[model samples]
Target: MELIESYNSISESDLLIIEEKIGYQLPVEYKLFLLQHNGGRPVLDGVRYENEHFDFVGHFYAIRGEMYHDDLLRQIEEYKDMIPKGYLPIGESPGGDVFCISLKEPTEGALFHWDHEQANYDGEPWEYNMTKLSPSLTVFLEELCVGE
Candidate 1:
């Protein structure tokens, strides 16, 4: 993906701290991505899940920043309850839906599209609201496209 207007650079320590705070190890590919581009808007922002399912990315949250809306750790804290366990909110869709990465086994490193409107407020079985987007962040980045 072609990203632009990325935030400040980050180091391994910054990622380590985030991992410690979140209590989950980030996918290696995603960590590499943060080091290269802490946060940014993708030029080819469109993503297609199937023949008719499509969405556009707004922006990726920065690892460290003064911008409240773009702060990764802050966003996680603010939405911790809403987000299902074992998933981390990594970015947002243009319409406010969340793009998350699985942190638990079997699905770790996989990316998912969380539909806010259909989210389950009740609990754990909330996996229904998440649609698998890619097997890994690496594949997800490679699949970004220009929307029509």
Candidate 2:
């Protein structure tokens, strides 16, 4: 789980691509993941290692399901000071209001998925594998112009 820089580098076009893919505009923080990625893979919390079994990239897309999510969301905001430096905070999902974040490519959406059916004390990072990418989402992202 290699913790890359915050997504401050994700381009505006790229951000839009993401929003279009997921069917929603991303919170400012989620947009960061796109930018700071710096052409490398993104990792969890702060770990980075190779996972041959999976793409590690695009592993997660469009997360769903959760419990006591509001409290966790509040906790993240309340304890923002406690969070380590370099740890970027994505935002709560509009559909389910669930906390959502994603891994950069190569880990496309890895860190967020590896562990499922359990809360990660961090909004339960989730993944949507490449194979599972929704046709609509694929079309949306594919068609949307990153505008270079």
Which model scores highest in TM-score? 1
What does candidate 2's lDDT look like per residue over 31-111, in tens digits? 443354422323421212231232223222222212333222333444344333222233321222222232333423311
In order of appearance, the predictions have TM-scores of 0.92, 0.27
For 45-119, candidate 1 gives per-residue lDDT tens digits of 988888554898899988875367889998888778887888888899889999999988899999999999988
What residue pairs are clashing in model 1?
Answer: none
lDDT (0-100) at residue 27 of candidate 2? 43
C-alpha lDDT values of all predictions: 0.87, 0.31
Give the winner by lDDT. Answer: 1
Q: What is the lDDT of candidate 2?
A: 0.31
Candidate 2 lDDT score at position 77: 49
